[model samples]
Target: MSNDLFINLFVQITNMKQSFLAIVVMTSLVIVSCKKSATTNTNPQYKALTEAVYASGNIFPKNEYKLTANADGFLLKQIAFEGDIVSKNQMLFQLESATQDARLEAANNIFRQSEANFSDNSPILDELESQLRNARTKLANDSINYQRYKELYERNATTRIDYERAELAYQTSKNDVSARRKAWLRTKNQLYVDLQNSKSNFRVNAREDDNYRIKSFMDGKLYEVYKKQGELVRRGEAIALIGDANEVYAQLAIDESDFVKVKVGQEVLIKIDVYKDKVFKARVSKLYPKLNKADQTFRIDAEFTDEQPNAYYGMTIEANIIISQNPRVLTIPKNYLVGSDSVWIEENGDKKKIKIIKGVENLDMVEVKTGLTEKSVLVLGN
Candidate 1:
């Protein structure tokens, strides 16, 4: 085409291009203005703030303990069941005691025999008494005969040799009586000792037999029964779980980092898995000094301050222990903070970073102690 026509075409194309560039620039400006307007800004406001430490634990009955058997045997009878209330020293189980029973019978038989031997009517004692009586009679006769021989010797009514022979016979009879009496006394003393030993043996066997009947250690409810009737039970084996039925407490594991902040009587907010929608209030009741090395945590116990939920043993729970709180303080959303100790504030349409003194802080908010006021506008950091 002609030079002028070509030039006209080029100029039209150039003007069209310039018009498109102008529209794009205007669109960019509008987008930029929108984004600036969309930037979030907040002001410090007076609000209640709480600082807490997170913990996890379980619910446990108070004074819980395992009931274990003291003697090995087959469980013959289960006298108590789960949920049964038992008194201290009440029999809860009866173990099979065939061997013990046999031993007890033997002990009783020996004890009865020993009793017969010790009684006044005992055959052994009666024989010893008869022997003693015979000895005494012989001694009395020998004394009379010796006195008669002495009178005969003094009156010269009998020969000296005859008197001497009579004296010798009297002395010999006296010696025989003394030996018989001594033997009787020794036999009687031996019988008495044997009876005492048998009585002691019977008592020991009786006490051992009683161990087959397991009894409760406290007045509480039975939470679990580990063994059923006819189950074999070994000594020191746990047979049941027992604890206070009406009272329960939270056993918490606090992290070592947060352990120092926990103390007795601190308020706790607990959320149990069973009661998902409800929050229970409690106070720290105990703090264990020993650290659990396996998990690097310390044990803490808390008691409910309000109505407790229907909780069972070992129910998992999450808790927040309130360390400190401020009823009303100047606070800002935690996202607005730039770093550990500074925040971005909007000043005269410009963003400025300023240092702040932070107090109590939670996951969502931070209490501003000395940096921003209620009127100060805070800018969320990038």
Candidate 2:
């Protein structure tokens, strides 16, 4: 009986030891879980917040082009300075056309040389008159001789050979007059050819000279003058820069990370670095499809909808591209999200549990997609 009581006591002690071990294990598990939950709720403010992407870039107009000169010409004059407003067809710069003028003159001289070949028939008229007078004198002499010979032959006072001789003399005189007239006309015709050539040269020279006057083709502000006075410029060289003042745009580069999020026609906020406190509203007019190799970024152009005084190109403007918006989404402070895919939520007092989600987690808030509801109060930071 005594041995049986001892065995029963030993069994009771074993049961108590197991019970104590179980309690300790349970307590340790509770403590570990509580600590984890508390750690996740560090950022209490962002627990109930919505999530979205954010990006920033520069602002610029969609239509931007660097104006280069078509030819190297001396920058003779500039109508306006870099910031001066100008109209369409307004002259940006007056490249000294002296060189072109000289070229045109040279071309004209060449043409004139060709035209100087022109000679008029009238200029040979005096020679024709002299030839005509000589021909008339020969004809008269021949007629007299022919008449005398004819009279003598008719009277049988001359031989047949004499009559034939008189006839030949008259015919030779007539032929000489005809030859002289023909030669005179030939000389006049040659002069006409020379005159035609001279006129052609003039036309060619006129055409070459007119190309020197360069005109402005677009309305804008004179942004720059590349060539200066007396500066010899070559053909097809850049001389001036112009940009539209009325229709201004913001030009900026966006990072590669934010490239996919930006789209044309998205509204963006612009803050001009030069001008403080003033915020400008702009719309993305174009997004460059190709990435910039140098910066590993894409170019985005924005048109300023908000009119600002004294706007100009190359003005650095901070741009905020709106990715997405949620009117009233649930949120929690970002610091509260401490777990690998979850956050801690306070149930009553210090008691906390894990909340899980699969959505955007911004710098300030964690978007809850699942395992959590707007009904629960999340602990952000202490």
Candidate 3:
């Protein structure tokens, strides 16, 4: 076609292209501005929640006790071994007393022999007394006869031989009397010595009988066996450990910081791993004074209100110690708190920061002492 017509058509097409570009740019800018304005009107939302300190620990019995021997010693025959149920007077152990047994038997035998001898044979004292009486009677009779002979000799009615005989008879009678006296003295001395010896032997026998065997002091369920037969044990050394299975308690170890807050007689809520969702009521019975060196924790003892069957020691427990019981306090979710207990608040459609004073809290909810009212909306990131 013509040159003028071709040039006009090219110019017209270029102008039209420029106008369309301008319109597209203006439309995009309006949409962008609209989105930016919409975003500025809305504040960042946070999810607000109030929660108490929710920590976890395992369950322990309060009445459980660990038994230990005060002195070191070898084990002997255990009358009651581990897990043996025993009565109060039941035997638990027999310590090494072979020596005591031997000694006692010897002592008892000696005593029995002495008793038999004392009963069967007449006492030396009695025999000596009888002999003395007989000697006295004989001496009296001899004196009478000797006196008569001496008198006859003195009167010169008898020969010299008769006088000599009379003198000899008198002297013989005197000597016999002296010999009887000496015999009595010897017998009396022997009786005194024998009596003293008998008493001493009896004491040795009594000691031997008592020391022959070791015995139990109290009736309990035997949970530990510390000794075996024929093991040498020192005096006062423990042979085994016993526990009362009839009653058991739970024990909980708490941090040193929480130690001050926990007090005796406080009620605690206990949950066991084995007993899920089951709440057991417990009363604080004891609070230990000394801290565990390794764990830096102190223990608290609590007894179950209801009789818990099959309660064992060292089972894991989670406890919630109710320090305060402020029910129905203004509370919120704990997640909203920022730094050092700070929360984000919305004011006039702008993000505003506020400090909140929190009180007793658990895992989910916290008691809000002071902060925004209940109607205040908390924006959680959507």
The best candidate by TM-score is: 1
List the RMSD of every prediction in angstroms: 17.9, 19.2, 21.9
Q: Is candidate 1 or candidate 3 better by lDDT?
A: 1
Candidate 3, run of 10 with poorest lDDT: 20-29
For 314-359, candidate 3 gives per-residue lDDT tens digits of 5676554545445246555445556556677676777667777866
lDDT of 1 at 24: 10
Model 2 ranges off by over 4 Å: 1-80, 87-100, 109-214, 306-309, 347-355, 358-362, 380-382
Q: How accurate locally, in lDDT, is each candidate? A: 0.77, 0.57, 0.55
How high is each candidate's TM-score? Answer: 0.82, 0.60, 0.62
Q: Per-residue lDDT of 1-382 in model 2, one digit per residue for the tens?
A: 1333223222222334212111011101222333544554332222222221223344333234455555555666655666666666555566566666776677667555544443332435676868788897989999899999999999999999999998899999999998888887786676666556656766665554433444556666666767666677676776666666556777767667667777788766565656655566677788888988886767877777767535455665555555554444444545566665666566767656675764554323455666666566666533
Q: Runs in model 1 with CA error above 4 Å?
A: 1-39, 275-279, 305-311
- Looking at model 3, residue 58 earns an lDDT score of 52
Model 2: lDDT equals 0.57
